[model samples]
Target: MTEGDSPMSSIFAAMAPVPERTIADATTLDAAIRAADTPFVVRGLVLDWPLVQAGLKSAQAARDYLAAKRKDVAFTVSVGEAGSNGRLFYDDAMAMNFRVGRGKLPDIFGHIASIENQPDAPPVYLASIDMDGFFTGLADENHVDLGDRDLLKSIWIGTRTRIAAHNDFPQNLACCAVGRRRFTVFPREQFRNLYLGPIDNTPAGRAVSMVDFHDPDFQQHPRFGEALAHAQMVELEPGDAIYLPSLWWHHVEGLAPFNVLVNYWWRDTPRWLGQPQDALNHAIMSIRELPADERAYWRDMFDYYVFGDPELPRAHIPEGAQSVLGPLTADSAGRLRGFLLRQLSK
Candidate 1:
C-alpha cells in the first residue's frame, strides 16, 4: 500500500511525511515561498537565528533570550487547567477551557520556565504574540528575509501543548525556534471530514477541528478516519521550519517541555480585496436559509458569474457596462464595499 494509506491501527505511524528541502540562503528561501503549493519541511532554514542557538543550548537559555527582548509590553496569555492536559479547547458546555490574563513577556516566560519539569503542568500558552509589538528587535535578530512580501510575523511560546487542527486564510511559514513540534496536516478538501467546530464561536480566531489529535474518537467522528487517509505528518526540530499553503488544516503539538515557534503569515492577494471568510459569513446569513430551488438558482448564478469564465460576460454586454462584473481595482473595491454597506443598512 502507498504511504498514508495504512490501516487504522497504525494510522499516524505510517502516514506520509511532508517533503523536505534544505535551504541555505535568503534567495533560495524567497524562491521557495513564491513557488510553494503544498506543505513541506524546510530543514535548518533558521539554524543560525540567535534565539534558536540559545534554544539549542537549553530551555532556560531560550527563555532568557526572549526575556531580554521584552519591550515593557503586556501580552494576553492563555492558561489552561491541569485537567486540560495542554489542549486549549472548549469544555463540555462549549465554554473555552483556558482563561486569558495579561502579563509582561518576562512573567509569561518565567511561568513557562517554572513548570518546565513539573508533572501534569497546566498548559501555559502565549500564542500569536506579534513579534514587533511585544519584543524589541526580536524580529530583526531572528527572522528569514522573505524579500518584498509583507508578512505578519507572530511568535508562539508555550509548554507542551496541542493546538487543535485549524486552517488560516494566509500562507504560513512556521519556524521552530525552540524545542520540538509535530504537525499533522490535511488538505483543504478534507474540510467536510474534519468535523469543524462553530465558525461564530471559536477557541482561537479560526474555527478548528473538534477532533482531539492525541486520542481521536473515530467512532464519534467516523469521517475523521477518512481525513487521516490524506494526512501528512512532520516533526520539526529547533531552527527548522515548514511552509504551508493557504487554507491547509494543521494540528500542532509542542513535544518538548518548553517551546517557541515563529510563524510568518501572508496572502498573495491585494489587501483591499477583503477576506473570503466575510463573504462566506454573508452568504450564510442571506442565502443559507433560502428555499431549496432559490438556493439552487443562486448557486448557478454564482457559478456563471464568479467561478466561471470572466470573458463570458463580454459576449452578452458591452465592455464598459460590465461594471462590477469586470476586473476589480482597489478604488473599485472601495466603492463595492460602500455599496455593500448601503445594502446591508437597508
Candidate 2:
C-alpha cells in the first residue's frame, strides 16, 4: 500500500501520537508491559529475531520461513471480495462481506502472494491462529519471552485490510512480524461516540464500530468525529511492536501486501474468574427492558452491590452469614455458576 492508501495518511497530523518506550529485551519488555496503563509503541522490539531477518530480506523469504516451520494443518481464513476494498466487514443488510473457509498455511500464502501486486486485490486474512497449536517450533523460534505467565499467543497474516475498531478484554502486545501496520486507537471512554454495531451479530467475534475509517459517513455517524478527537494513531514497521491495555479500542490496518502480526493476549485476573462480558450480556437481557423507574432502581442496586465498596457489603452482615457476599474462591465460583444456571432454568 502507498502513502494515500489509508485514511490515517490524511488525518495523521491531527491525531495524537501513541507514547513510545525503548525496551532492550524480553525482561525489560515484560517490566514495561506490567507498568503500562495505556498503549505505547516500541521500536525494533524484535529486530534481532530470525523471522524478522527473513521478512526484511523479502516477502517470499518470510513465506518460506513460515512454511518450513508450520505443521501441515488447515486453518480458518477470511477473504473479502475485490469491491470490498480490503475491508472484512458487514454489508448493508448486516451480512458479512467476506467468506471464511479452511486453508493450509502454504496454499494460503501462495494465494496471498499471487495477488500481492494487484492494485485492486481482494483481501485475504489468516487471523488469530494459535502459534503453538499450528506450528511445530515456530513459537519458540520467533518469540518474546514474557516470563512464565500463561498467555494465548496468536499470529495474524493478511494482505492490505481494514479491521474496524474493537476492544479486547485482555491486554495485548502486538508485534509487526512482517510488512507494515497502522493502528488508530481510542480510549475506553470513547465508546459512546464510536457507534458500535450489534453485539450479538458481529462480523468477527467482537463488536466493532460501524463507521468506516477510510470514508467515514459523517452524516450517518456524526459522533465518530468526536471519537477522532480523542484518537491516537501509530504506524509500525517490521519488527516493531505496540502494547495496548485491556478495553482500549483499536482499529487496525494492514498496510503491506503480505503483512503479518503476532500478538499475545492475557488477562491480569485469575482464569477461574467469570468473564465480565458474560455478565454484561446477562444484564442486557435482564435489565435493559425494564421500566424506566425499575431500571434506575436496578442501576443503583448494581452500583451498590457490584461497583460499590467491597467492604461495605460485608461490613453489616455477620461474618458467618455473608455467603455469596463474602470473598469467592474456586469452589465458591463453581457453586455460584451452578446457582445461576438453576435460576436461569426456572
TM-score of each: 0.94, 0.95
Worst 10 residues of 1 by lDDT: 1-10
- TM-score of candidate 1 against the unseen true structure: 0.94
What lDDT tens digits, residue by residue, belong to model 2 across residues 109-209? 88988998898789999899999999988889888888887899999999999899999999999999899999999999999999999999897788899
The best candidate in terms of TM-score: 2
Let me know the TM-score candidate 2 reaches against the reference structure.
0.95
